[model samples]
Target: MAKSKFLAAASHDLRQPMQSLFFVFTALERHVGTDAGQALLERLGQGLGALKDLLDSLLDVSKLDAGAIVPELADVPIGPLIDETAACFAPAAAAKGLRLLRDAACDVAVRSDRTLLGRIIRNLMENAIRYTEAGEVRIRCRPAADGVRVEIADTGIGIPPEHLDRIWEEFHQIGNQERDRSQGLGLGLAIVQRLSRLLGHPVEVHSVPGTGSVFSILLPAASRPLGAETRRTGPAADRAGDASGLGRVALAIDDDAIVLMGLRSMLEDRGYEVLAASSGDEAIAALERSGLTPDIVVTDYRLRNGQVGTDCLLRIQEFLGRKVPGVVLTGETGQDIVSEIVALGFGAAHKPITGAEMRAAIERQMARHAGASASPVPEESRVAEPA
Candidate 1:
């Protein structure tokens, strides 16, 4: 309990700066024209991404420890999931001169939670590519006696026999004693282990110190074969080529001046007319002064003077005599807090959110609000606040 609280507090503080930097970098991406400058920026972006990954790993551990992740089992086709995950990491493998191979012919389906299973595959593949300095990383699916075995094989520096079991422990890196961020924070396998256990999947690892390593997961076969599966794309994919905020007015509030500035800049870049503020009163005042109804509201979850984003959003809606699409930006990962935010009929996004992610959240909320406007107010939004 003490450790979780400390981790949450530290993460909240660190994510503020990371969020500001993300917004700044997104706004800067369009200005770099020279090849050399672009390359430097890309390297910086990779480093930033690594930092974000490490923080996310910490949050995952905390969430798992808190029993916040509940699995929803279904018939998950293995082929398409592997294909999508492989596509995401193909660039990383190519950058390291490693071949990423997959058994695309396998059409087997497994009964498991798709998101959790995909996370397992992703962590294993990331771990494989990180340790392997040469050769190829291949993912193969084969039939097992009672289930299917998905294996990731890598030809690089293999793990020692004695350290095989210890590798699953948190912050236990094989060769990285210096705690290099580039190599990773050593939390990937820890997360994989926790998630695999949660999903009732068994994990296995074998390595020859000088040759290579292979990691496998055993998943139960689906009772029935999969029918035609439609890929589940999140809000980002739905608005892939249409990220423009043209003619849309947005009201943003944040206590941190830097974060507020970054938000304003990012929204402006997306062609939004922004009304920015640092507090609820300021936001209301700005709205009244502008005499323009904002199409969306974006605010930090915790604000100055004991103000919360949900209340601020509701207050704004009350003043305008209508519900406006709102997205609450927070650094808190407590499940109760998240559930409360969702109960308020507002979209929720964790801190250190990238520019693209923020855009997606805004669009998703706006789309939901548009759909709900034609009907009565959602019952969830009318629930009384918890004491």
Candidate 2:
């Protein structure tokens, strides 16, 4: 079967059984206060974690083959991505009595896909922690040649030299151990390999037979502001900013129910009063029926009737008698479509979106209309920082 078809069918079918099992596990765990029962819950959590890893790896392979994966370059603080990844893996390490340290003291920046870069470092970190039964896992960022080099180093039972080259190959695990068997489908490094290649970067690994291993990814210098660091040291707890502003009603449109629910919850949680619609016609009717003026319209780039987001935005703007800020989200939007989006005065965000990237995109909209007021409530007459 085609990888695309495999993914669509498998993800759909997998979710049903997994979600059902998840609920049952949750219910059973809730009723069991004993340590033995708690062990079952812990094991169940690990199983779910493993299942998610498999799904993500499968999707990564498919995306890479289809050439659907690419870098999203933006001005980002160097410390933030490392910090966020460290925070995510800290609990897992703590559970194993392992120390996680982040030496992200470059006080600099790098131009790269922040999300994908984060994922690469994160996979390395998780794999490091998973393989090691003791000591620490550390992430370090430093200035390299013209860009930056990030290292995820773990003091674990290191890989033998014979196995080093083969490890980054697809589904390859270094050692034949019970621990290695349970942690992943051996796709962590494969993801790192695919992402690095796609982004025109390279990841280098150094490991001793029994001491430790260090994996490094290098990239170019950053171009813009390095604001909003989400390290544990920062005061911006949760750091995921709100999407609401100036009474803008963003239309959340997607055919996938899970994506719809997650995005709607995420947007609403960020304070946007979202109008969810699964189809383009429904999205248009939503605007007409609510008798409400939309401040900004956000829709999935693909709609059910094969209508593109540009088409829907055009129709809605025509109905409103003016152009509104539009943001299109997509799973796979080609380069040509991106040019069209920009030409149509819209912005695009590709999935799966991080809280920070989503906020950044929305802020672009806010910044665009910041000082100018609208009728629903005139845009803030106050001055906004220049883009």
Candidate 3:
């Protein structure tokens, strides 16, 4: 428990700056128009991306060591995950004059934690892009005896046979003995190894010193596609198109002032009327005092005094006398919190979220709320009046 608490706090604190940088870059991207300015912005964005990757890798190690991460197994489609991964790494690969390919069997489902599995693949893709100077990075999915084997093959500088075993060690790097920061902190593969073991997925590597390398992970197969309920609320849903936020009110709560401010700025820039608060109680009080109902609620999962975003969502619904759609923004990776968020029927997005992601989630929630029938507030949700 103490370890979990420490890791949670550390993750939150470390992500604060990255979260702020995301918003700052977002705001900057809107104002810059010159080619030179755009180039500078792009470079800064890349730097931010590297920093975020490092921070996430560190957190993953901490969480894994503390036994805080648990897999939320589900039947997830391979096509969508493959497509998303390709889209994400295409820019980086193109920047290096390399081709990114994805050849995965559609309609194939894998029983695994989507987020963790995605992270593993992403790490491989990022590493592939970093080392490859001119060739291509290919992602292929095929059937295995037990399940499916997804391979990330890179035509970059190949690994020496002797160094293959040491590659999984923390902070171990090959070919760049100078400890070049641009090459990454050498934690990506380490995290991937840990995550693969945690999910009971077997990872394999093949490489020749002068040739390239292929990293593969074998995941259990699922009998059928993910259910409608899972599809509707999964994190991947946040990758949809940007919807307009005109006339919609969003109540956002976060303990960090910088994060709260960044979120408000990002939402207001998209035409949302945002109500910002520091905690669940504050949000409820704001709604009560103003006698205003919100279209959706956006909050950080870990708030002050061990208060969670779900509590705020429930309280906000109680205040509004109807069920209100909500989005939970979090930096924590523990499966327990993720399960709770999904069970509570809220859209979840991890922290250091891009502006587009945040907008998509809010818009999706708003659209759902508009289409669904409003349910009456439950008796248990009613607050007791002061005597």
Candidate 4:
């Protein structure tokens, strides 16, 4: 209840400045055409980006509570994840005169959840971009025996050591006095810390008052052989070749005809042979008689007749004999709902969906399922006993 009020108040307060800033920057970009105006517009853009990050962090927190946050762990190339995240903030970093640099050795693939990791780094980078008035933001990575340590070091206003411990706490803030009056302060780091804990990764910070700050994340090592797996391990597959079987019999069960149609279209466009079931009973009947075995299940979180998406996925996976991948795509974003989704350990994507994002989510599910078994599954093998 308190969180609700805080969110409402925060939204109303923050959006006001963000909207005004957007318009002012847009107008300035259109008219001034001068270098000075360009710089000012860039500054406004950074401010706006910071504001957006704060709000996004809030939404993520709410989603986590609602059980909508799901982690689909897969073999992801460490380099691309960092590169993509860094690219997203490059403009903001440049506008602040920060030289953003990244270092990588070989393509190290790790068994980890990509979206959450991306968000974690993004939170730190966004903060680095926001607080640092000068100097560079450098990302350094080195492989550990079992995991890897990735660091985001920024030459900005160094965090006080006492503040470092508190920074990861929910709703904790340090230097955003101005931004706080308008919108928020502590949400981003809190979100980061929460996600890191969920993924079982350790986050560390080192800062000297006048020098700079370095935030490091230690993640489990990627499982990749130095052979064909290396070439294939670079996050290019739907599921590791071993797990591609899951999407072969993909199922979309939703009561909403529009949702069913949309999911069908999405699957068809992505070249997945999709089967639709309108209700839990129908889905059960179809699976009981027919030889249709689902490799992956994608369903709406809410369905008619009080049958939830979680129940449906659980039932079908139980039937499949082999463990299969599942994703729940929904429109609801309350924290409890999101938390339930996350606790189930499926990929959760919010609705009002974009085609690309939907496809990407499916691909991640597939790859994750594949990478779960480093030892290849022979093409003709169903080695496991039937459930």
Alpha-carbon RMSD to native, per candidate:
3.4, 8.3, 4.2, 11.1
Q: C-alpha displacement of 60 in model 1, angstroms?
A: 1.5
lDDT of 1 by residue, 54-114 (tens): 7888888888877878898988788888887788889999999999998755687888998
Worst 10 residues of 3 by lDDT: 229-238
Model 3 spans > 4 angstroms off: 1-9, 24-45, 74-84, 99-111, 221-242, 302-307, 381-387
Better of 1 and 4 by lDDT: 1
Q: Report the C-alpha lDDT of model 2 over 1-387, residue by residue, as the tens digit.
A: 485667744653564345334434443554679998899788877777677557657767766766756577765566767777888998999999999998836666677776787778888898899878899999998779978888889889899888888898777776655646565678788788888888767899999867889988887776754545422333243232345553566676666665666556556655677888877678778878887766667677766756777777776666666667777875542456676787777888654444445667776765576566543312332122213
Model 4 alpha-carbon drift over 4 Å, by segment: 1-55, 65-68, 180-185, 226-331, 334-387
lDDT measured at residue 309 in model 4 versus the true structure, 0 to 100: 82
Which lDDT values do the candidates have, in the order given? 0.85, 0.70, 0.81, 0.68
Best of the candidates, TM-score? 1
Model 1: residues with Cα > 4 Å off, grouped in runs: 24-47, 229-241, 367-387
Which order, best to worst by TM-score? 1, 3, 2, 4
What's the ranking of the predictions by lDDT, best on top? 1, 3, 2, 4
How far off is residue 335 in model 3, in Å?
A: 3.1
As a whole number from 0 to 100, the lDDT of residue 104 in candidate 2 is 38
Lowest lDDT block of 10, candidate 4: 377-386
lDDT of 1: 0.85
Residue range 108-181, candidate 3, lDDT tens digits: 78889989999999998998888889889999988899888899999889999898999998899998889888
